[model samples]
Target: MTYFILQFLNGLQIGAIYALVALGYTMVYGIIKLINFAHGEIMMTAAYFIYFFMTLLDLPYFLAVILAIVFSVVLGVLIERIAYRRLRNASRLSALITAIAVSLFLQTLYAILFTPDPRAFPLTASSFPVLEIGEITLSSWTLITIVVAVIVMILLQLFVTRHKAGKAMLVVSEDLKGAYLMGIKVDRIVSMTFAIGSALAAIAAALYIVSYPQITPYMGALPGIKAFIAAVLGGIGLIPGAMLGGFLLGLVETMTRAYIPSSVAQLSEGIVFVILILVLLLKPAGLLGKSEREKV
Candidate 1:
């Protein structure tokens, strides 16, 4: 029972990180029909910014996080304006290829500038306190991860449902032409969506690095892919669905690794994809997503 509880907490921690990243994925997809494959690269860029701000500039952790998030928001908006805006009227395939290209470009640029070497993150698991209750032990990181994710989710829900700018985003998502005709700045709303998503990714980047305590130019790739899968599993465009999917994926992956023999524990990742396949086959619209027919 103690072991089970321990793994559950671990799952929540991992899920929290995935949820944060998936929120950005879902928000961008909800607003624009694009997948934004470079979104993960934005997270990577933010992590690098944090690394440099703390290591080179000797800034405080909280200040470094704020700066990194701001930089990432700018980067996301720039990517939308420079790479995606022109392709808005273009074919989906063209936009997809461009997203891939942008992701590759960022990866290459980071590799060149920072080198491909993995560096130790300034913070480590030991940096946080651990608590014990009877036979169960809890890490401060775990509590912080789950708490922060929940708070962010609540705040985002309020923003979407209560704020005027957020309402404009909904209008733009539902009908771009109608939004434009209604005097809503569609472009600005889209940029704002990217900005918000990038900020979430930046926060996730900080938490993830602190947990894993390692950094590399391509560090965001796998986690980013998994988060995208989580978004899809939860119904890609639904905010709550993204959170649910992340938690499910994290729990499943953690349990699989925990129970499976060490020799085949590597199969945990493959199992995650298998679960996704099963879910999609059973519910094509996703767990919480409703199916919609496209106009001919």
Candidate 2:
């Protein structure tokens, strides 16, 4: 029981990271309906930017974070403007292929520039490094990650539902044509979505490397894919649903590793897909997603 509780807590931490990345996936999907497969590369690029700012220039952590986020936001907006904007009315396949191309381009570009080698990322530990409750131990990073994820999700929800820009985003997501007809700047809204989503991924990348400190050009690929799964599992276009899916997926992965046989423990990643399949079969719209009626 003690072991189980420990694993569960760890899972929550992992889920929090997934929630951050998954929120990006859901947000972009909600607006404009593109998956932005290149998002992971955006995060990767931010990580490198942070690293460069910290090491090469020896800047303060706070400044480095801000600059890294700015760089990521600019890159995201540029990708939308340069690669995806024109394809808005084209087939989904075109957008998908473009996203893939963007992903490969970044991966290769960074690999060539940075040599594809994994670099060590430095992280500061919490003031209270460990928390103990009757035999279960939790690290500060684990606790912080969960708390941050929750706070970020709450803020995001408020931004979407209450803020003026948020309403514009919702309007655009609901009906781009209607939003345009209503005098809302649909292009700006879409750009804002990409920028915000990319910035969130940068934050996630920062939190993620603390747990797994190795940084590489391809680092964001796995987390990005997992987060995409999480978004789908939680109902792709729903904000709260993304959070729920991330936490649930985290619990599933952690629990599976703890209980499954050691020899096949590697299959834990595969199990997430199995859960996804089941969810699709049972509720195609996702756990919190509602079915939408489209004109034929």
Candidate 3:
């Protein structure tokens, strides 16, 4: 039972990361109806930027994180302007293909520049502290990750609910045409959404590197895919739903790994796919998603 509890905590920590990344996917999709498949690469680029700053410039960790996030935000805005803006009126297939091409281009760039080798982030002394409660043991890093994730989520909720820009984002997401009709500056809102989401992904990447230490060009691929799945499972375009989906998926994955046989442990991902199919079959719009009604 203690082991189970510990595993649950671990799962929650991982879920928090997924939730952060998933938010990027959901928010972009919500506002622009674009999947932004290159989001993971944006995250990877941010991580690499931080690493370069730390190694080449000898910057502090916190400063590196901030700069990385800012860099990612700028990159996101640029991509939206240069790539997505052109395709806004084009077919959805065109936007999707462009996104995929961008994703591959970034991945290839990283592989060429970073050698596809796993690089270790500079680990501070605080990286590996352990904590114990009763019979359960947990890492300090895990606790920190969960706390940070919660705080970020709260800030995001508050922004979306209370801030003017955030309200604009909500309006755009709910009805882009209506928002445009209301003089909402739809293009600016979409750019802001991408910037905010990419910034979150950068933070998630930094935290992930803190926990795992070793990172490669492809490190973001699996996590990004899983986070996208979580967004879909929870209901794309719903912020709270994305969070719940990420945590639930994390718990399910962890539990499956813990209790299932070793031979079948490899199939945990498959299990998640099965669950996704079931969810889609039962609720095509997702757990918290509302059905879209077409105008006759």
| Overall lDDT per candidate, in order of appearance | 0.89, 0.89, 0.89
How many clashes (backbone atoms < 3 Å, residues ≥3 apart in a chain or on different chains) does model 2 have? 0
- Clash number for candidate 3: 0
Q: Output the number of the TM-score-best candidate.
A: 1
Residue 7 of model 2, lDDT score: 93
Which runs in model 1 stand beyond 4 Å of their true positions?
none
Expressed as tens digits, the lDDT of each residue in 78-98 for candidate 3 is 988989999999999999999
Q: Would you estimate the TM-scores of all the predictions? A: 0.97, 0.96, 0.96
Q: Please identify model 2 stretches exceeding 4 Å from their true place.
A: 124-128
For candidate 3, the per-residue lDDT at 23 reads 95
- What would the per-residue lDDT of candidate 1 be over residues 25-49, giving only the tens digit for each residue? 8988887788888988988999999
TM-score of 3: 0.96
Model 3 ranges with Cα > 4 A deviation: 124-126
- lDDT tens string, model 2, 185-282? 99999999999898898888877877887889999898888888899999998888889999999999889988999999778769988988898898
